[model samples]
Target chain A: MSTPKKILVHVDGTERSITAAQYAICLASFYHADLTALYVINTRAMEDLLKARIFLKDEQMEYEHDMEADAERYLNYVDELAVKKGLSITKKSSRGSVHKEIIDLVKADDIDLLVIGELSRIRSRRDEFYDEAERAMRTVPCSVLVVKDEDKVWEMYESLV
Target chain B: MSLIDLVVEDIVKIPMTSNDKPDVLRELVQTLKDAGQIDDFDAVLQAVQEREDKLSTGLENGIAVPHGKTAAVTRLKLAIGIAPNGIDFDAMDKNPSKLFFLLVAPPDQSGPHVEALAEIAKLGQSRAFCKALVNADDAKEVVDLMKGE
Candidate 1:
């Protein structure tokens, strides 16, 4: 029954991310806690270039730029959703490994709880690149909520509306 | 509500090659036709394009659910295609999509169409699902993985 202060929600502009955002917003509203939505850009394109994939260099740059722009557009949507729900929310974007950035933010912001979608790539029980959230859960000094893919929240929404 | 609502068969290709969005989409639609899932390829493509013009179905995690509810389709169906190399989809993430869940629902079933899109979005958000999709070698594997097997 400790008071909640700040909560961080990781969003990757995926539908699962949106659902996670929706749930986070609800939690923020209930606790009157500040919500921060984050999007992480994968640096694998740069890694691909370093691997000597010469033909992909230009395409890789274009892809990176597009991803940044797309992240901005999606953050705008999250911002709007926060406004509509009367939740105090801020959105931030970063580049690099998703788990590292998320962990850094948790410590820097002193986050009370971290919420993210539990899916295939990010839910690795083991593995460096894929099981980012699981890795963070073990190391970070905060509670983690991995939203299930088949959670009944949407079903409830559909039924209520 | 038969499980085989969509007959992808040999039409599903992995590591599909396409320089851009239109070409990839056209190829996927043609695959559906070749698999005998749809009667008219051109009409279905047009419908999908027109829908894209209105709103992108890219939900996240390098995934795009480019769907069309068209009269060209007699039944509700879905076709999944994986582009391991990723295709430019003008998605919100600007990441070329390695996974696509192309849905073709009857124009009349608006509710299910939206539901399907949401469901696909939910599936894409799961990092595990996206990883499996990127690694899947063929259509049957893709279908089986999507069905949670």
Candidate 2:
């Protein structure tokens, strides 16, 4: 309800996540709020590899290193966008459940508002529609804004020329 | 890159006349050609259409960002179109898309293209900003809103 003082955007490699980061930057600029972009590496996926013994010991280490690099790369891209706008943003990365990390970060940073993209990869399952977003929305302490691209009236003008 | 800087003034159509996606894209692609942003309008259109064929750029709420990486543009080019009545864009949310951000860039210029796309995506999230853009009656008003003036 009140002007947000601290805003966090969940950033991943997806286009939708990039949209969320952009929305967060705008909201942070308008409200003069501190902005942070958080990227989680999905440690659970790595754990699955461990359980399956897919990679040998040395290979596992290499895989983890590559994944870490990817996380930093994504975070840096977000940082670049913030810098271009003449605004500074904090970039954070974690390794664990995506929604849990976000929820924890919200509490740890005293985040007042959380911005996220509306759609994510759909899984082929009985409850295909429910995704991490549903969980994050239900549990996060701060106000959550799921940024969705909307149709505006202005896009319709046809060129007479 | 600032979305405002990339906006071709002559092409920022408000209440864009085309109701369907392909025509709207054609109109915008022509805008780029008229502004001299792209050399071959048909190539750029094909590229953008190809991108869309992969997946609908129709994002939820009301925005569609149709983009392509092609040789037609030497640098990054952006055109904004708004349709007050909304058109069926086959968006992920299945809602009619009213605001369009047409991004065209050379295949090598992924950096600028991504930056501008991110900037537009962020700007699109603001209900207040979108409202102001919708109420804007002319190109100047639209440009001013993007400039954050």
Candidate 3:
């Protein structure tokens, strides 16, 4: 296989996912590759939250606004990091199941590499969400890099922290 | 290192009053400094802020693991803090953060660092475990819960 020219990073705004983004940015910088950072919102979870909003309609709106603001903050952070590192990057935000969104983005953007944070190695059948993400990995067309907690790459980011 | 390698003591504060991410981090860093677990509190704060400039540490389920690897630390350590008021760590869930696991590791240990992060991610995803952390009133309670007691 040839070297990947573009990378798609899956960031959930979690510490782990953000860390994964950091790594992707660094790699992009090294390879002089283009990067697309994506945030996937679980629509099902949002629907559930909306369904439970019996007592406070305003509160739910406030909650959603807050979430969007947070996502923006995180995306901006990544943008700044890329700028500082001299890496080219594009950011995208979507609301849907994480796996499907990631797959779609891969096909739409011609992404050569897909990066994601590892959830857990030990998951029961009850961990349906992670199970779905893991299953999606099998069908993804590009090279996949799962940033596990046990990987040494985190130390590189840790140094900058 | 395993998440089990990290220990929580009497530092967990249930019902923390701060509702913002900066304030929560401020409080937690201060607590660690006061407890003498860390020296040069300002350095740690700067490191965290610099890291936050790159990305948020907020995870799912109202948990934020704000961490940094710094030269000020001699070894890897973990501090657990709980805020019942749910500080905004800018979690992906858009939910306010109630539990914080502040990680500090030396700049040299590369492999253990990632393992430590992975361990935290594993623990953070466990709803039951996070609930136990939110309910913890003191450091020992937090430690015991992380220990799966």
Candidate 4:
């Protein structure tokens, strides 16, 4: 705690992720903390699909490229939002199990705080089991903030801009 | 960007005549230029060479991706060459490389290029896939294989 010096946000291309990013940017400005946003490409799942032959080799490659593009698009949008508030934030993307990547970076970088969007609504035990963001929240060893009340967070973001 | 969207018969050379590394690189880059995927052959070649000089793109499993980013292409472009005979490209696995993927792009457009590189790496994991591509008889066949046909 001691006023988190490094803040990490996990973006997964969801509407809630954007809300989380905006909230993180606002908080970074407030506390002068270093903010870094990360997106993991879920190569683990892609490999599983390949193993099942659900995706052909070429299809798996193409799908990975598309996912990478998605990651870049989301990261760039978060960067633009941070820039609008005159804050320079770090953006990073990795390819692996989403939750594992988040946990790894949190441990490696000694992230003081981790911010994430609202957890996906769990439809079943398996759904909760597979939700990477929810898994990341449970696994990362740091203060976790789950941004909700999208309208209120959006208003705060607009005020900063 | 889907790797298949950039995949085409015009840019693929099967049973490549080139027997060596430099020639294979030249042949693949030339394929891109011939297909109008790149305009400045010299710049594209140099960029690829510079990248190769720094580190070999030769990966294991008979795959080699020689790539670079430059103003030669407006977007990410790919050219593939299959050398059944294999050539020494200083591969990490120390084996000759048979599949060559030449990629060029605008300097600022790195996302697609990196994605393409990762795609090739992922594709290398499948021996069956690599074998199918290597055994392809013609450019159309190669394109079809890459298109996942």
Candidate 5:
């Protein structure tokens, strides 16, 4: 494929996803493409928790609030990395099925490439979450780059800490 | 902020002698204390140990990022230990972990804490970088290797 014109990376507050973001940044830099870092809050999981009555109403609200905070922190980190690279990225977050939100965003933004971490390699807290992650990977509209490199994708980004 | 900023000349210990996970952790925590990064070494050490008790932060590729956030530190601090002999960190890969990055952060500063941990995790992926890190003659070389990135 010719150089991608747009790239979207999915981050889920995991180390592997951060690595994937670094990979996406490298590709964006190489192709001079527009880049975005997307974080999906996995509200489905939260809903399931509610259905299971695992947490009380106030507890669920507190949990959701914490998750939102985590999403903001991570997305900001990606933004910081982008700024250090002399690049800017659109930071977007959604609350719903992680994969569905990502796929929808991909179509909406006309992304040419979707950069994501190797989901299977990194263990998700829930087994069903892994299934959702796979489904999103399989259904994305554009080319999908599952970043699995055990090497530094961008030296300069890492140095930025 | 970069990990380099959190590290000083004494924050890194090459050729760590502790053979077990707990001892190695203690040794590294002591290193941080000696660097004047933390005041209550015992409290910080316990926090790290408790984190490890939850789940080993040991990743694949012989790297482990053991981290904790506590009031012991006013800001984010890092201590690196390279055990050439490889300590049994109970890593996911079932391999001995040689590169150790111990991160201590204040409870309020989650951003820098996570950033430092993620940076080390990404750095763990580079074979050449890890190889060079292990081969570096002194703490300065290790710092240079990280800063040279």
Candidate 6:
């Protein structure tokens, strides 16, 4: 395919997600693509937890606030990584269903590529039905890249110089 | 690094004597210098003041995490001071801040610094935890409470 004009990476503070961000940065730098990093605070999960009585109303609020902090932390880390490579990246965060937020950004931003970490292990049929990242990859109009092999990716990132 | 690991007994002060924001900040930074955690006190203070000038680090719920990035410290150093009487730290909620967590780190160590801030935000969610820390009698008690002991 033609060089991607825009790329969006999803980060969630996970090691694999970080590796995915690094891979996307490398790709963006090589292709001179505009990069956007997004962190979706899984409010749907929190709501589900509340519904299941696992979280009380106050607990939900506190957890959401904490999640917001987590989002900023992850996005700032991505910014640092991009700066190290002399690339400026746009950082966006949302509070809602993770996949819905991602797909909406993909459509609105006209992103050419959506890079994500290895689809979280699908342990059950229910997971396949409910996984946000998996659903986003399947539905987004853009091409998707599932980054894996953390060691290789880390090595590649370190070799960027 | 975890908050427990970073905020040891040496830097934890209960019933902090400072009744105002700048004084509290001064006491915490001085505590770190006295503990030999950082040299070039002026450089570290300048870094923190610059960051504070941009925006108050005083979060809601009686918690203020005043952090800075500077070369004066090679690694992350944390100092906690509790003033049960409360000090106005320009918190978003407009409530007096009772817990002060001062973080100083090298510029290259942004990752840990951000993590520490996020951790503080999460911990602030627990009102009980903050209360316990403030009501504690001594620095060792403050450290124990932070350690979840």
Give the clashing residue pairs of candidate 1, or none. Answer: A14-B60, A70-B92, A119-B126, A119-B128, A120-B127, A120-B128, A120-B129, A121-B127, A121-B128
Residue-wise C-alpha lDDT for candidate 1, range A17-110, written one tens digit per residue: 6777777777787778999998776554244322322113443454456557657876787787777766568889898766788899999999
Q: What lDDT tens digits, residue by residue, belong to model 3 across residues B1-149? A: 24454464644555566767888777777877877778888888886776665567776788887776688877666767788667778876788888887877655432234345545665666888688778777777776666555
What are the clashing pairs of model 4? Answer: none
Candidate 6 C-alpha lDDT tens digits along A1-161:
68999999998766667999999999999999999999888777666544433334764675567668768888999999999999999999997877789999999999999999876442323221234667788899999999999999989888886
What interface RMSD does every candidate have?
Answer: 13.6, 16.1, 11.6, 12.3, 13.3, 13.2
How well does candidate 3 score on lDDT at residue B146? 61
lDDT of 2 by residue, B27-62 (tens): 889877877777798899998888777667788778
Q: What would the per-residue lDDT of candidate 2 be over residues A1-64, giving only the tens digit for each residue?
A: 6899999998755556776777777778778899999977655544543333322355345445
Poorest stretch of ten by lDDT in candidate 6 chain B: B108-117
The residue-by-residue lDDT of candidate 4 on A15-89, one tens digit each, is 678899999999999999999999888777667645533335764676677678878888999999999999999
Better of 4 and 6 by TM-score: 4
The C-alpha RMSD in Å for every predicted model, in order, reads 11.3, 15.9, 11.4, 11.2, 12.3, 11.2
Interface RMSD, model 3, angstroms: 11.6
Estimated TM-score for each candidate: 0.52, 0.49, 0.49, 0.53, 0.52, 0.52
Determine the C-alpha RMSD for candidate 1 after optimal superposition of all C-alphas: 11.3
Error of 3 at B60 (Å): 24
lDDT of 4 by residue, B58-134 (tens): 87777887776677667788898999888888887899999887777665444445445556666667788889888
Superposed model 5: Cα runs more than 4 Å off: A1-161
Clashes per candidate (backbone, < 3 Å):
9, 28, 11, 0, 2, 0
The residue-level lDDT of candidate 1 at A35 comes to 94
B46-117 per-residue lDDT for model 5 (tens digits): 988877887787777788878776888777788999988799999878999888889887764543454455
Which one wins on lDDT? 4
lDDT of each: 0.66, 0.71, 0.67, 0.78, 0.75, 0.78
Can you give the lDDT of residue A70 in candidate 5?
A: 73
Candidate 1 segments exceeding 4 Å error = A49-55, A121-139, A149-161, B1-149
